[model samples]
Target: MALKELEVRYATKRSRDYKLADGEGLHLLVRPNGSKLWRMKYRFEGREKLLSFGAYPQLGLAEARLKRAAARLELAAGRDPGARPDRKPAMTFEKAARAWHEHRAASLDPGHAARTLARLERDAFPALGKTDIRAVTSADVLAMVRSVEARGALDVSRRLKQHVSQIYRFAIPHGWADTDPAAYLSDLLKPKPRVRHMARVGMEELPKLVQAIDAYDGEETPRRRAVTRAALLFTLFSWARTNETRLATWDEFEGLETAEPLWRVPAARMKMEREHLVPLSTQAAALLVSLREISKTGFVFPGDKPNQPISQNTMIYGCYRMGYRGRQTVHGFRGLASTWANEAESYRPDWIEMALAHAERDEVRGAYNSALYLTPRRRMLQDWGNLVEHMVTSDAGVRRDDVEEVGPPLTAVA
Candidate 1:
């Protein structure tokens, strides 16, 4: 008789092992220890064989019957249902992709590598992960791309296709795949949107913005407020990206007490994947000293989470708190610094570019100019620091004219 689900559920263990047959070679093997295992008894080539279809509850009755039906089909085709295939198992798409990611991650930043793996797991894995690398058709890849695009994530969709193509490229060289299925998928995606620059205050308004940042006390604890304030000031004074500043650690700094304090940003953390040197001015170094007294984690601006730096939005929200939302961004400080320094005749354009860490276009020039202008860049930053300090100490509603009258001249560095 075919066993009812209730009977399977209520079946109790006896003092020994026993079998409850559901007919057609499908049965439940109930043991004395209250374990229910699914097994199939069949004959192939005049020889009797046994196949295990996992355990009960996990395998369930209907799924086990499905497995039995499939096994019967295999038997009809003259293939052994329990025997292993002669050839090796094919490499799965997930396996090939993970191998590629591991190889690719060595040259990538740790955070970037983690985000890439996360995108794969979230989007690609569910659709094509278990399929054989060679068996993944272009249509299958397109389906995954369209699924992401349907949700208004055109950028993610485009990047997903790129990553898929890269995976195939990695696979083909390893003999895991014969062709790149994702190679021609670029045209199928939507067009990329235009770039919009971040908002920032003009040179004339910088002093007022500086004053606002000084007075910002956005409903947080005194310690949290101080950390956010210091993060913003450091980013402004050094003109480093908020991402670089937020992720900074104590060991990245050197010679803080000396005349030549430096922040050595590791190659992995930088946008161009090259080591960058930020010459810290006295104001920037002083902020670090104050941060060291209250900082509880390894990060210079530690967040609420354990051992993690503050979020990239910490400084952005600080700007918002000072009523500058949509008028300024944390990254705008770089533009402001560039404009101020470039307008001044004393500061060299290359020195300003190096201070901003903009990648030099020519490779040979980039390599040759890597350490060429540290001294001049340091002098420029010190002048910038002095200007910022002067603004903070001056009147609350200070203007460009007032700053020009009382502060160090913009061209005073040279």
Candidate 2:
């Protein structure tokens, strides 16, 4: 017979342990010490097993019955209720974080994913790893963030908080956590330091820089010098980042001998993770033609090691050799290009931004604008290339007429 609630409450403890049977393998085990525990007896594969549902009154009669019903459901599904309960293992902060990282890593670049994991391991794991993710309070998160901030890594602290918040955000949907402890941490962190822009030369000084690059002879071999000059010039003319140009392969270039010469940068190498189209001008095409004749490796600018691209410091060292140390950077060429184009009345700002491969701020607009301004951007870059060529070939520097000429019309080239 099933035990009644009043009987369960009024049941007396005996000298030895005793049980009041509830129906269907569920019973209340009342001990001599005045402790009552809910237990269940079930058969799985001809073997009897016992499952505890906690102390009586705490689990209550109705809840214990529900547990029995759930256990029977588990048995009906061919699973052992005693061995494998419906509840999963407690989710710790580190475990949740790692799970989140694994889920996030699928869409991220390998290097970026590695760095994110490294940051979590370095800043978050030591303090919060073993703590239950649901139990982690805002104060607990703040303490960990403060520890990082104490070491003067304000930026790291900020990123750590963001990572923690993201972990919680990832956990909540899966029922691992109920609250995000790191959500309010952004306001608590120290203000970031002032922004420092990369060093770059002014437009007025561009002619002298171009002249210096043309006459550059710092490399031991003439062939090495040619490689350096071509690499730098290509970066400048294409308005591409130094790393993009450094990692360029011959296969990325197309239609070199034709009118519509192009450099198709793959999305993997790009900073924004989007493929960029660079319409190679007449001068830029000529540089690639020269590079092809002296190509040593797959990389357009082969580094010291075989099958490797040029080092990050290679172009920086080239700028240093040109006596522009601390005055200009290889990356600064894009800034100069942006400044020149924005100041020019002929070029559209959107076309100039597209040429620079800057990400559009609006997601919907960015999706719609992908490679949409190609024709106008091509003309803008071609005009910029003409101005660069004029500066390089002329001793008198860039004149108004030269900037206005931009060689022949788009029809003549295309």
Clashing pairs in 1: none
Misplaced by over 4 Å in model 2 are 1-89, 102-104, 146-157, 251-282, 303-313, 320-323, 345-377, 394-414
Where is model 2 poorest over a 10-residue stretch in terms of lDDT?
A: 402-411
Clashes (backbone N, CA, C under 3 Å), per candidate, total 0, 0
Per-residue accuracy of model 1 over 168-241 as CA lDDT, tens digit each: 87987787765567877777887767857789988999988888765556745666776777788789889999
The lDDT of each candidate is 0.81, 0.78
Clashes of 1: 0
Return the TM-score for each candidate structure.
Answer: 0.55, 0.61
Q: What is the lDDT of candidate 1?
A: 0.81
Query: Which pairs of residues clash in candidate 2, taking residues 3 or more apart in a chain or in different chains?
Result: none
Per-residue C-alpha lDDT of model 2 across residues 60-159, encoded as one tens digit per residue: 9999999999999999999987663565448889999999999979887676677789988987899889776765667778989999889998867877
